[model samples]
Every structure is written in C-alpha cells, then in structure tokens.
Target: MKLHCEVEVVSRHLPTLGLRNRGKGARAVVSLCQPRPPARGEQAGPHSACLLVSTMKDKRGTRYEQLKENIEQFFTKFVDEGKATVRLKEPPVDICLSKANSGSLKGFLSAMRLAHRGCDINTSLSTLTPVKTSEFEKFKTKMVITCKKEYPLGKNFPYSLEHLQTSYCGLIRVDMRMLCLKNLVKLDLSHNHIKKLPATIGDLIQLQELDLSDNHLESFSVAFCQSTLQKSLRRLDLSKNKIKALPVQFCQLQELTDLKIDDNDLIQLPFKIGQLKNLRFLSAARNKLPVLPSEFKNLSLEYLDLFGNTFEQPKALPVIKLQVPLSLLELSARTILFNRIPYAFHIIPFHLCQDLDTAKTCVCGRFCLKSFIQGTATMNLHSVAHTVVLVDNMGGTEAPITSYFCSLVCYINSSDMFK
Candidate 1:
C-alpha cells in the first residue's frame, strides 16, 4: 500500500564523520512493493520485497531498499492527535517518516510490518498508486463556499473539516449536512437568508466561533443555549436579525469574549448577563432595550456600546418583595448556591437545575431566588467599561439597571447608592 506523508531521512553514520546533515523534511509517497517474478527464460535478479520512498524534491528517483534485509528496526511513535512518526533502519542511515495523518500512518505501518515478515500482500495494484501531496491537503481540513452554486448537494460534509464557511450562499436554514461535522471549530454562515437555526447545531461541541449575522432569525433557541455550545462557543455575532429577546439561559456561555447583537429588535438582554466572566467586548447598539439587567454592573469590559437605546429613568423607592419565611424551594436553591454544589439532570430535576444555572447573585456576595427585594438604579456606563459609547444623541452615558437584594437588611445597607 502507498501512503502520502512528510518524509525525512537521517544518516546514522554522518554525525560520526563530523559533518552536518540535511535538517529538513519533504513531501513523499511511501510504497510497499511485492517481488516481481522473473519472466520466462530471463535470469533472476536481486530484486525482492522492498519499501520505496519517493521524495518530491529528490533528483535521484525513488529510493528502493529491501525491507527484510536492509531494515534493522521498525517502530512507530505517536506525537499527538492526527500525527505520528515511523522510524526505519537502513544500516548507515535512518529514515524517519512523520507529520502523517494518524489513519494513513497506521495503515502504512501495518503493511510495512507484514511486508518485512515476507508475507504476500493481498491488495490490488491500483490502490498502490502515488497521489499528489497537494491534492491530499485540499481534501482534508477546510472548505469555503461564498456562492450558492459552490455548495455540495449531498448530505455529508468532509468528516475531516475543521473550518467551513458558506457566507452569501442564500441559505434559508442551516444545512442539515453540517450538523455531522463534529470536528468543526469555526463556522461562518453570515450574509445568508436563514430564518431559523436547527437546535442540533449545538452538537458541534468543538465549535468556537459562530457567525449568523445578517440573517432573518426572529428568535434565538433556548435549546441551543442549554446545549454543549455553552462549553465551546467563544465568539458569536447575531447582528441585523429580528430577535426580540435572548433566553435567560443564554448567559451559560461564559466563555464568550466578543459579542455583537447590533441592529436587532431586542427589548432586553439576559437577566444573568454578568455571569459571562470572560466577556470583554460588547455591542448591542440600535436595540429597543429600555433598561439594562440588574447584574450589568458586574461586567468588566474593555469596550461597550449601547448607543440609540431609550433607557428609563430610575425610580426613588425600591420595589420590596420580602418573604418572612422563605419558601422551601427558595431555601433549597439558596443552600445549593451557597455551598457551590454541582447539579445535573441526572442528580436533580431538570427545571430545578436550570433555575440554579440562572440563579441571581446579590451585591452582598449572596444568591437569591424568587424572594428578594428589587430596585432600579441609574448607573454610569463608564463604571463598567474602559471605553463607552454615548447611549443617545443627547450625549447621555447613563442607563437604569435593576438591582436585587437578598434581605431587608442588605437593601437598607445599600440604599444610599440608589439615591
């Protein structure tokens, strides 16, 4: 069998002669050829079962060496995912083959071992043809399509694809074929006509950046917010959509560093927006948001823009909802939050687990459930950002944000900030 990979040849006897050797690798096709039987009435030659390495740059053609006689040792070492190294012995020189895809390397190594033992390979000769290294690379890692005509009509995407882009393709919905690309890291579907997203898009657990900007989406899926995307999504763009609101569970994507939802119809952001500790750049410009969430003060940002929003004026009196005896559900949730206990659907009810996932945190370093005192206070946008954009054409940089208090004493102690 023939395998395409990067090949390096090291001379074992060159170093002892006090000479520097070639320190570079080249693209090569390695093949295992069976012994050709002598033709009728022709004298037998020294040809035997051999392994051939044809380097693309080598001026002297293919290097053919008898596998059983010349090779003193043959072994393989794994370097990392999708990479491996194979060492071969050729008396005075050692041939090192590396940077090969794991699948091809394994097959090549197995065939080499069997050929070295003088066994007959049952494979067809057509499968042993050398393939151009450039062609191999083009099929393996990434695929980009900017026009609708370039998209594949089949159900399967290349299984090795890590980055796929289909921008300006006029797609009305996410291609179901794309859901099978589990290795995908960055998916850019921007400038499409997609009106809705498949909840299964979150099945791509390795996805880091997803761009669905300039679409016709009217709502973001809560199922997506609760999917494995929470662990991998780092950057997202939903600009120029018709989304009216984002689910509270949307804050579960704590890994986000850059977010853009500009030119949407959002009424308000997720209530637990501050849970995203890694968020640094935020732009929600031209939305219909009336006020920011109570936890907006918890964000530490490098840049923030809330321009063109009509923010409400803060009221003087705090809205009180104190419970003399906290409900059992509230008490249980508080206990779980205070102790930092981990919960999942398997360990507790799914709804209860979701409640804990979006639990409110008070300014006093405590968590609160439904029983808490609520207040609205005006806050300077500059307090949470190093660079702040004016919230309106009147040069206003202040907006009202809600605040929650766990108890009457906590509200009384922090009431001066509201005034």
Candidate 2:
C-alpha cells in the first residue's frame, strides 16, 4: 500500500545540522502533505484527522506553494453532521470529513488498510476524532458493527455486560435486548442526546448504578420506577437536563443511596423522596427550590449540596461545610453543653421533636458521659446514631444531665476526669 502524500523540504541549517554527516542536529521536521491512516491496530476517529509538520530540507531547501493538505480520510463511512473546521498546526488549511457514522473499529481498520496503495505517511494519530472508543475492543461478543449503520432498538448488542460507559456519542437510542445484560451493574450514558429510555431497560434487573447526565431527557418512562430496576438500582444521576418535575414513580427507588439532580430546572423534589430510607448523598444544587419539603426531616442524609438555590439559609438547617464530607454525629460530636452556651453547630439525635423537658432520656436511651474541661463541668454523649433533626438555638441553660453512657469505660473515664 502506498500513501498519495507530498514531502517537500522548506528549511535547512547545514552548518548547525552537520550536513556532511547528515541527520545530526535538532529534530528534522517531516511534513505530512496528505492524510494518512494510523499504525496497525491504531484506532482512528470518525472525523478526519489532520496533522501538520515543518518540512526539513537538505542543502537546497526547496519550498512548494506553502500548500498541501495533511488529512487522513481513513474513515470510509460517514453521514452528514455539519460543516466544521478542523485546524492543524503545520497544515495551514483544514481537512473536513464525512458526517459521523457509528461503526466497528475492526472494520474501519480493514478499510483503512485497503485504502493505502503505496508508501506509508508518518504522523501522530492524536488529531483524529474517535467515533467509537477503544472500549469496543473490550467487547466479548462475536458481532461486527460499522459506522454507516443507524442505531436501532434491535437485538444485536453485546451480551453479559457488567459495566458500560458511553459518552459524547450523540446517541439517541440503543438495542433493547442488550438490556438483557442481567448481570450488568453499572451503566453510564452521560453526554448524549438521548431523551427517553426504552421500557426494556427494566431487563437489567441487576443494574445498581446508572448515570444519564448531560442528556436531553425531559422525564423517565413509568416502567423505570416500577420495574425490577427499582429494587437493585442504588445510584442515579440526572444532572444538566431540562427536566422540570420528576415522575411520582421515582419515589419507588427505595434502595437508591445517591441521587444527583444538579443543574436542572427542578422547582421542587418529589414529596415522597423521604421514603428512601437508605439515601446518603443528595445533590440538588443549581435549582429553583424555594423551600424543602417537611418530609425531608425524616431521612438521614450525610451529604447534601443545596448551594446555588433560591432558598434562604434556613435557621433549622445545620451549617454544612462544602469541602468536608459530613459524618454521623457520633464521629464529630465534639461539643458538650452544660451551664454554658454552645456557639458552634453540633449534630445529635436528642429527639428535638419530642417535649425536651419531659423526654428525660436520650434518643438512643444510652448512658451519657460527664467531664470537666476549662474548669467547667460538662456532660456529653459518648456515641449514638444520628436522628435527622435540626434546631436553631439550643441554649446550655435548658440542658440537663439525664442520659447514660454507651459503655462502662466511657462512664468511668468521665467520672475520673471530673474527679
């Protein structure tokens, strides 16, 4: 195979380069005056890749029109996308390509080899835009796909999938039976143009994590929340979209631990969101939320990102540091309140909803620890799980030592410290 390329020398430093010996100084620039395919097994993008380089000439230093297109039209198949300029450093003019067509890398490689009729052209393959990524090479299925094919909801997808992440593909749909990847655990479809998922998505009963961020989806299908996907789905991301309201079925995702709805136009979240008893992380940043639902006080959320919202800082909301990951009260319960004011925020599950004066016992009914620090005697809780309750002002004057320590060691240590 030969490359229909043009090579011309435009520069020569005979003295510095040691022309007598030849090839002895700086790197000699080799200009690629025509598009060239990447090395064997080297992947190329759907778009044409153009590479430009300076021409290193001999003693004569001849130049040609300062012209030559170094574009590798390796991709034999392409559909109409739009006209866009692909610039290169040395190759002054840009080399455009056929519209994007999704296809098989193996086939593309075979076609590229067939295109070359003569000598090879040397250039970096970085300038090419990959339509399908190297992730394709990892496929175990025996099917061969090509770029000229439009994706249909057919049954030709890979099988026995566990993880799949396809991003920036402008994808609109996928094969339905591929959802038959029952063992699939994680699937990321970020940065695509998909608007809706097929009902067959439920076939992925074992899918635990799904990322559909940066898409055109306005809402989800009813089957998504009602199907087996609801039982095993643990994480979901719906960020950067035009979704205004979530379907009521979303509340059925009881096993969901993390939910990201950032950068959307959501005015409010589903009222039944508190039903997710296991939810730990929730990010609703950059939305139009004015006030949170009262049911929100029921769930124990460790990390909540509500910045860039319309709601004012609620006094009942505990102050949260954006940089620090929030831990349960037992881990960060460093403050003790007794006959003194507690200016710093604290996380505790002392049942603020109940009549504090009548609720003589701690939320967990565990023993409390009393200690002396700074010449002041104070009582603190040794360790207890968090109860999602927020209070604005907890004056020390109203507090009384009435709970028991979780362990005898805590009691003895506090008693020894006080003594």
Candidate 3:
C-alpha cells in the first residue's frame, strides 16, 4: 500500500541536532510491505512486515527508513486540518512522520495500525493507493476566462474554487453550475451581456466580492437582498448597468466596505443606506438621483464621488404629511422596528414585510411609515467623506439630502435645517 503526500521526518533523540531536511517537509511516497525472506546464511528477523518512507526528489537522492527493529509504540497525532503525525519508538530515537491531505493520511494510518498488529490489510489496493487528480484540480483555486473559448466545458465547477472570473465572455445569463460553488469567495462576471442574475446566486454563502459591472442588469433582485449574502458580501460593483432602483433589504449588508454603482439609472438609493456602518468607499456618479436618502447623513466614508448626478435643490419648507392620530399600520410597523422583531415572508404577507423593511427613519432615530413629514436639506459632501469630488461642472460640493419626521414635534425640532 502506498500514499503520496508531503512528509517531514523528525528525530526525538537529537532535538538540537538538525537532520538532512529539518523544518521544511518534502514530497514523498510512504509504503507498507511484507518483510523480505532472509538471505543465505543470514539470521531471520522477528518482524512480519515493514514500513518505508521514500522522498520524491531524485536529484537529492532517495532517503529510506525501515521500521522493523526496536519498534516500540505506534500512534497517530492530529496536528491540524489536512495534517497528521505518526510517531514510532526505536530504543534510542523516536521517528516522527508528518504529512497533509487528511484522506491519504487516514488511509496510511489505518494500514500502519494493521501492519503493527501483524494482520493482513483487508482493504482493496485501489483504496490504498494515492487518489488520482481530478480535472477541476488543474485550476487550483482561482480560474479566469476572458472569452467563450477559454471557459471550461463542464456542468459544474469544483467546490474548491474560491475566485472565478469570466469577464468579456458575452454571457447572457449566470452559469447555473457556478451556484454550486459554496466555497467561492469572489466572482467577477463583468463585461458580460447578462440581463439578470439567478436567485440561487445567493447560495454562495462564502462569497465576499461580487463584480457584475458593465452588464445589462435592469434591476437588483429583492430575493438576493434577503439571502445569506447579506452577511458575507463585502465589496460590490454594479457600474454601467441599467439598474434603476435597489431594494431596501440591500442595506442589510452591513459588512459592505466598497460599493460602485456609477453610470446607472438609479433615481434614489435605498432609504436605509446608512445601516452599512463599515462602508468606506462609495461611487454613484452619473446616476439620475434627484435627492439623497434621509439616512445618507449617517455614513462616514473615506472617499465619496457623486459627479455627473442631477441632484435637486433643497426645498424652502418641509412637506407636512403627518397624520393627527398615527394609523394602525404605522404604529404596528414602529413597534416591530423598535422591538427588533424578526419578520419574513413565512411570518406575514410578503408585501407587508417589505413595507416594514422599507419604512422611513426619522432624524431623531425613530422609524415612521405613511405618517411622516418629508423634507430636503443641502449637505456638504465633505461632512461625510475625507475626500470629495465636485458634483457637477459648477464645482458644487453640496447635494440635497432628504429627511423624515415621525411627528409634528420632531419636524419642528429639525425645521431650522430647511431654512
């Protein structure tokens, strides 16, 4: 039986003295076999089987260690993930064999245990041999394809794949096979012709960076905003798309740090955009945004760019739409938000849940829905960012930001800002 993997041999007898290959391990083939018959006039050895370790480097010469004499204790140690160590006692010195690839390591340990017990291994030879490499392993972890011809012909991607890029591939839709890559961390489908993304794209729970820029995506899916991606996604690029609006659930991705949605048809960002506390870089240039969201003032960014956007001028007076007595819907929504109650499609009507999620937040850190006053105020971009770009050719650094108030008293308290 043979196992192929990296190996490192350490001697416990001489701790200070360095062996031929000390710290760095080498690729090797470890095997177990029956002891050869004694030669003419040679005394027979007591062992029924033997273990051998052979290095793979031919130029460095083969190194063999036979474990037949003075064999004491044999046991395995789980050093770490994909790694194990086997230790054998030989009177004066202790031999330690360490390697990686847990599958191979487990098989080797099983064979070694059987050999030490003087019993024949009942396992098949194919099971004992090293695993053959799969076609998917050829790409290692990162795979990039710039054109259709470069894309691999396969129904599924390797689960080991972490980063995959298919830019300029002219793909009209996301490959369904890629949704199975749960271990994926980054996926770049930029410069493609994709008109929409599959909801299953959110199944990649490990994904961190997603680039769908330069596509024909008309709108971001609400399903995607409610997926597990909200917890994992850190960087997103939707630049040069046809996306007109983003779902309010998009703000739940608090892990986001970098966002680029430049050159889109976005009329307004999500109302709860300030929920992304980690955001540092933002670029929404060339959009059709009329005014920023009420929560836009909550963000603290390192870089801000709103150039080429047609922002509306601040209004002279706030629009008063407050209800004399808060409606039942507004009161219930406020209760849900204040109590942090978890709501989903399974718990209530989908539209009701969506309305609650998209509810507006007042300047005094309270939520409002249907019974709030709407107002707009001019805000200097430099107040939120360390570096700011001119919003237009007029060298304007200020843009109109919307605000909401849950009550008449709240609106009166913030009325000075509209003057």
Candidate 4:
C-alpha cells in the first residue's frame, strides 16, 4: 500500500526580527530514524555454539558508563575522518543485544550526548532506538516508529508532554507555510488532509514531478508557475481535487509532456494551454468542459482523451479555405473511416462531421486502404470518416479541377479537387 506521510514542523520560538535575522533563532534539530531489522540468518538457537557462553555485567558502576564505551567504540574512525565525534554526558547502563533481555532505556538516553563530539557513532547509526527519558523529547524530528516495542513508552506513552525550547517543533498539520523542501525532486502528498500549500513552494528549483492528487486543494500555489519550474517540470498529477478553473499560470509549464487533471471540478481549460509545444498526452476526462479550443487544431499532438466530459456533442470546426498542399499534409489517427460509403471504390466518404479542421488524407495503396475501411474510424464513424476534398485555387497550383461531376467523385485523389 502506498502511504502519504505529512510531517509538520512547528517553530516554538517566534522572534520579531526581519527575514534576515529571523532565521538565526536557536532551535533543536529533530530527525526521524526508521530502524533496520536484523537479517533472517542472524538469529541464534539453543544449540548454537555462540549461545552456550554465559554473559553477565557486574553492577560496579551506572549503565551510563557502558553506553559511553559502546558509543566511543562505534565512532572512533569517524573522529579521525573529520566527521562529528561522540561525547557522552549521562551514559546508559548495559545495551543488551539478546531478544529476551532488553537494554536499559535510561542508559540509552545518556548516549545521545556523545553524538558528534568523539566518534563516528552518528554516521554509523545503522539503526537508532530512542531511550525513555523526559529530556529525550528535546529532539524535534517526529520519530517514525518502525519497530514495535514490547512495552509502551512509559506513563506518557500516548499523550506525552515535554517542555523544550526550539524555533520549530510539533505534529503535522494540513496548512504549512514556506516549508523548505528545496532538495526534493519528486513529492507525492496525495490522499492527504492538506488544505493549502504556500505560494513560495516554487522556491524548490530542483523539483521535476509533483503529485498533489486526492487532496482538498481548493486553490493552487501560483508559485508553481515560476520560471524555475517552467523549465524542468515534466509531470504534474492533480487529479481528484476541488479546483474549478485553470489559472493562467498553468501555461508556464513549457516542458510538461504529461498533464493529468482528471476527476476534478474544472469547467474549462486555460486558453494558453495550447502553447505547450512539447505536450504529448493530455487527459481532461471527467471534466465539465463544454468545448475544446480551436487552438488545439494547431497542436502536433498524437493522443488526446476527452472522455466523460460535459461536451454534450462533438465540437464543430470553422470552414477553412485549404491553402497548403494538404496532399503531403497528414492528419493522423489510429484509424480512418469512410462512413456510409463502403470501401468498394477509390472515392472515400469523408467524416467531415467529426473534426473538420483536420484534412484527412488517403494512402495511395492497398493494405493501408483495407485497414482504413475495416479497422480505423470505427468509433463514432460519422465524426471521423466524413472528410470533404475541396477543389479551388488553394493548395494545388494546377487550376482547380472543375466539373459538374466533381462533387459526385467517390475518391478525391491528391491531383483531384472537390469544392
């Protein structure tokens, strides 16, 4: 199952300084660490030779001393490598590795003080287990619990309270402002309770794909249209939302190739949408769009789906005077239809009723023509096969082929014309 985790950071200290100095407020750094489980073969049975040895710790001193020794041993090389060293303040008792005998929680609490002062322990943390201590709450990052503890986190397990001084701290919420996620390349806050995103989100210069689907996003972050996003963004999924209209900023996605806005409250698309030169696939299915702009005719697009839209009927095209030699001009579709007229003769029935702006051309061959008649142009034949071959002083430099039977001609060849 895919999950969307929204982590919110609440700054406990709010200073009156301007944006410049305000960033300097002291704060606790919170980090969430998910533990790694031991490998399958690492388990020991009663017959195992390693289990035969008896291990005991004499209570000559506090467990804190043991934790300090363990941390120091783990980070010796890190200090030599110039990384932060571990420094123990209140060391913990014995750290038991046996599944039956758990380690002392208080001893683990003191071990954190040596995090970056004396050893590589911080970087070598293959797995981190928090100790049960009131002071441990000072760490701000929300702890994503991956391991199930045999016992609860003490008396304050569920509704615990701790007093710590920091610039940011707390549980996640729906509306967050200026969340600095500059390093994020792809983000999916889908199916979340998030209500709003700050306009400064465009500050993330490296973002390539963002999925805000299935949210209560009544509005959009205009910062998305910033120049930084316009150049690199490729995919944007905003389906299942309450958005009603496409903002003009949407046109700024010049590099976008796939755009999905299906299952929304949108009534119309932004007029500048056709300005996307690299658009390959566009899905506006299940929308309330009455009609698509004629500008779509100018697109070199190959695939388009307008299923489940409010377009009661197909749109009509303005009668255009064919100017270019449309013979070489290819209006491509997966299939072609020759309407009420069968594929018996060269004269093909045009589906002018479907999309008139497209000048459907015929392939001067056999197999291609057979498929054109039997396969392509199957759905809504009336809309796709009824093409009209116009005869005039337009594309063909040869004088317009005029004849009383011109309109009656079944197959309008490249050299022929039909007005």
The prediction achieving the highest lDDT against the true structure is 1
Candidate number achieving the greatest TM-score relative to the actual structure: 1
Clashing pairs in model 3, backbone N/Cα/C closer than 3 A = none
Question: What is the lDDT of every predicted structure here?
Answer: 0.77, 0.47, 0.76, 0.39
Tell me the deviation in Å of residue 245 in model 4. Answer: 0.8
Off by over 4 Å in 2: 1-155, 312-419
Predicted candidate 2 versus true structure: per-residue lDDT over 275-377, tens digit per residue: 7898888877788766554335456776666566665332322222222232343222322222223332243344431112121112233312222111112
What TM-score does model 4 achieve against the real structure? Answer: 0.37
Worst 10 residues of 4 by lDDT: 397-406
Model 3 alpha-carbon drift over 4 Å, by segment: 1-139, 154-158, 344-349, 415-418
In candidate 1, which residue ranges exceed 4 Å CA deviation? 1-144, 154-163, 176-185, 200-206, 222-232
Question: What's each prediction's clash count?
Answer: 1, 21, 0, 36
Candidate 3 overall Cα lDDT vs. reference? 0.76
Candidate 1, 1-419: lDDT as tens digits: 66655667777777798987788767666666644545789643223556666665542335556665455665554522334444446546666665454566677666666566666545532122344545445335588999988888854566558899999999999998787666679999999999998989887877999999999999999888879988999999999999999988788888899999999999999988988999999999999998899888889999999998767787778778778899998999999999988889999998998788777777697989888888888889999999999998889888988888999888879954546
TM-scores for every candidate against the unseen true structure? 0.75, 0.40, 0.71, 0.37
Better of 1 and 2 by lDDT: 1
Model 1, C-alpha of 161: deviation from truth (Å) = 5.4
- In terms of lDDT, the poorest run of 10 residues in model 2 is 367-376
